[model samples]
Target: AQEVHCLAHGLAHCAMFCAISGNAPEHPVISTKSGHLFEQSVVEKYIESTGKCPVTGEPLEAADLLPVKVASTVKPRPLAATSIPGMLSLFQTEWDALMLETHSLKQQLETVRQELGHALYNHDAACRVIARLIKERDDARQALAEAQPSAAVAAAAVAAASAPPTSKGGEPAAKRAKAAAPAVESSAGELTPEIIASFEATSKTLSKGRKKRQPPADQTSAEALAAFGEVASEAVLPAGPVCVDVHASEPLAAAGGADGSVILFDCAKGAVGAKLAGHSKRVNAVRLHPSKPLALTCSQDKSARIWNTDGTQLHVLSHSGDVTGVTLHATGDYCVTSCSDKSWSLFDIDRGSCVLRVPDGSGGYTCAGFHPDGLILGTGVDSVVRIWDVKSQQNVASFEGHTGTVTCLAFSENGYYLATGSADTTVKMWDLRKLKNFHTIEPGAAVGGLAFDNSGLFLAVGSADTSVYDTKTWGTIKSFASGAAVSGVGFGRSAATLAATSADGILKLYGSSS
Candidate 1:
């Protein structure tokens, strides 16, 4: 055969190198079927001869001869590096680099997935917040609608009561009672615009009148205080007296006892006027009707009784638990009672129906009272005092400082301050306008009762010993020794006599001798 040498002095085709095995230099192109590469001219000539592959001896055609692309640049390699071990080492290095790149791509994909999940969680939270806000708005609107009618009727009654005597002297008692039962659904006790205006007007007028008619100095002087002594004692009951209230215009007093008996007394004669009994447990509080001849009493029997002084029971306000406190409105037709069941109820006395039931957020209420104008309510729970707008049934103000249970609460006569005594042996005076505690005094013992005289100038605290403080100076003006814990204290209708009932079943009377 003629000496036809391989092109470029090559001994054999170098698929991965520049004319040398294991010498990868540039632009590598792999075969699609055999996973190998060859020089373009070498493959073409091999296919033309015998029409078969040199290595596999397979039938090959010219079209099967593909080009193996490479870069123009090349590097020389050592002849010893053409061994199979060196080639294997080079392949392993390339495989490692490819695996590292794939791992980096996988990490990036996982991070993207985590970011997407966090975005979805935030979106869900925002949606829930929006839904909650919308629900609250709807509930407030419904409450306002339910409260308007009753507020209107209550406003009219207050206006009539506070206005100067008209030709008719105001709405008839029957007509006022009828208005108390609103035609709307029973979800009452909301403050409407009309009611707010009416209450404000009445308060302004009352304030001016009070300023002009301040009580005389000699009314509660120490010289007058010395005249107080033990008066006639009523028949001893099965249990000690717990609460007492005097008729605002009569010489009569009503006392509720632990025996659940509401006893009436004639202050002038020092004798029992009537004994009204109905409750099956201890009586906690009693209040004389402002304008009517009725007496309201709350008891541990889980009910409040409204009775005439003549021993005639009028209405029994039943409750789910022990009634702890009761207060009648200035109109004498509406009453409010607080219970140990975590609720307080507003009632229509003449209609004998419940107008509203309000639940306290902190367990049960210990005591409750109405503002002199009847527009606001004060309640004692735990160690704090909460003031509510009566019409709206919303807590508008809260006063805190007591370290123990707020056992007793009494609003000042002028409606400017509230006196609350706690079991911590401290009494605090709260200014309604400022919504802050104006003064705090520590008595020698735990306070059992609190009372403000009709002048709003004197505050009495019943503790180990009953002591009176002048509101202007906030000083102890006088002290009385009852020898026992005084549980109830109050002034007569005319503010002429001070009376206190001791836990030993004795009622002591104090007055200035003429």
Candidate 2:
């Protein structure tokens, strides 16, 4: 009975444990033998009181409480191993996200670096440009500073050199001497002052004795000559021919005869030496070469003839229209002629051909001449004088001042001055160096001819009134009325005799001490 009770108690306790743990009956709890006996005895006592089974509600019995042996089978939960993989996948995803962010940051950093590099390059270039500019500015400043003193010193030196020397009294010596000189001559001559005074009272009568008288109307040449009282014999003669050692010295006297012949007189001999007679019409102009034996004569027949001193015709230049004037080169190798056709042509003696033709597009040409250097040629067309370069064959300058036709021109020996005579009764002196007009001498009548002395100290101008001018001050030294309206004037080679031609077919000569 105790064994039955003990079995019942063990069965009850096992059933209770299994029920609390929710274990299967086949997986029941096992204990030691002593503990099982204690449990069985407890269970038997309880069962007798209740008379019921604790499990299954069958009946209280020791046989029914027998221990059943079951196999130990326990399966793991589904997908238990997959938890670790899922966790690993989550970690891998997080790592990928972090890597992506890092890459994006790196890309941004690279972009920023590239931008910075570009900006740095631009800044460097700007800095270099600025540096170059600064350096250039500094160099310019240094050059200016270095040049300032030299410029100032040079200017000051020029001023000093140009300043006139001062005297102790602050007056020029020349001025003082001029003021002290006597205005009247001393009475020391053999002719007493009283005699001189008496002579001066009849001076008008004496002057009238030399006056030209008009010939009887319709008088013949013989009658006129007889009445004129040997006027040709009374004419003054130059000392002799002054042969200048210089080559091609220009003739002092160039005259055109009524017979259409051109004659060049030796300025020193006062004698006719050469006659040029190539023109079929009246010769209007004649000029000797500045430094050669060649002569150029323009005629009303619309042509100019180049001739040798021996009267040999070298060339007969025909123009499209009437030739008015002709001038020879200093070397006598070239010549220029102005025509009423409003054109001028340059002739080369060596080539025997017209090298250039210039049209006076504005007006008709009246006169022309070569400059002293022979490189510049000047042409007077109406009231304007045009200068041209022969080598370049170009017009260089034009001078406009004359109111009427410019008829005559003379260049100074030094090549620094030029003189022109116009039909406006004015003579102008031009400074070639300065390219400016220097002086104007109004002779009160149409100026027909002009000539400068070899020394360039005096100028002879022929008009209705023949006059001599002091070149230094442009002052008229003397003026003598010609018997007839003068057509030409020239200085003799000695610079002492002045010869003039008039419309009356008379050639008059005047002597001067100064």
Q: Give the number of the best model, judged by lDDT.
A: 1
Query: What lDDT tens digits, residue by residue, belong to model 1 across residues 446-473?
Result: 8888888777777888888778887888
lDDT of 2 by residue, 1-514 (tens): 4665565555655533443234444434322232222234445555577765544344555543445344455756446345988767777988999999999999999999999999999999999999999999986765554333223323433444455666669844320101111111221113335433443344334223313333234322222211221112112212211111111334345567545666656654546666666676666677666556666778788888877878888888888887877776655566778888767777776556776666645667777776554555667867766665544334454566778888788776445667888988888777654445778888888877777765556678888867777667777777767766667676544354566776665556565322
List per-prediction Cα lDDT, in the order shown: 0.71, 0.59
Top candidate when judged by TM-score against the true structure: 1
Give the local distance difference test score of model 2.
Answer: 0.59
The worst-scoring run of ten residues by lDDT in candidate 1 lies at 175-184
Candidate 2 positional error at 114, Å:
87
Tell me the TM-score of model 2. Answer: 0.49
Give model 1's TM-score versus the native structure: 0.60
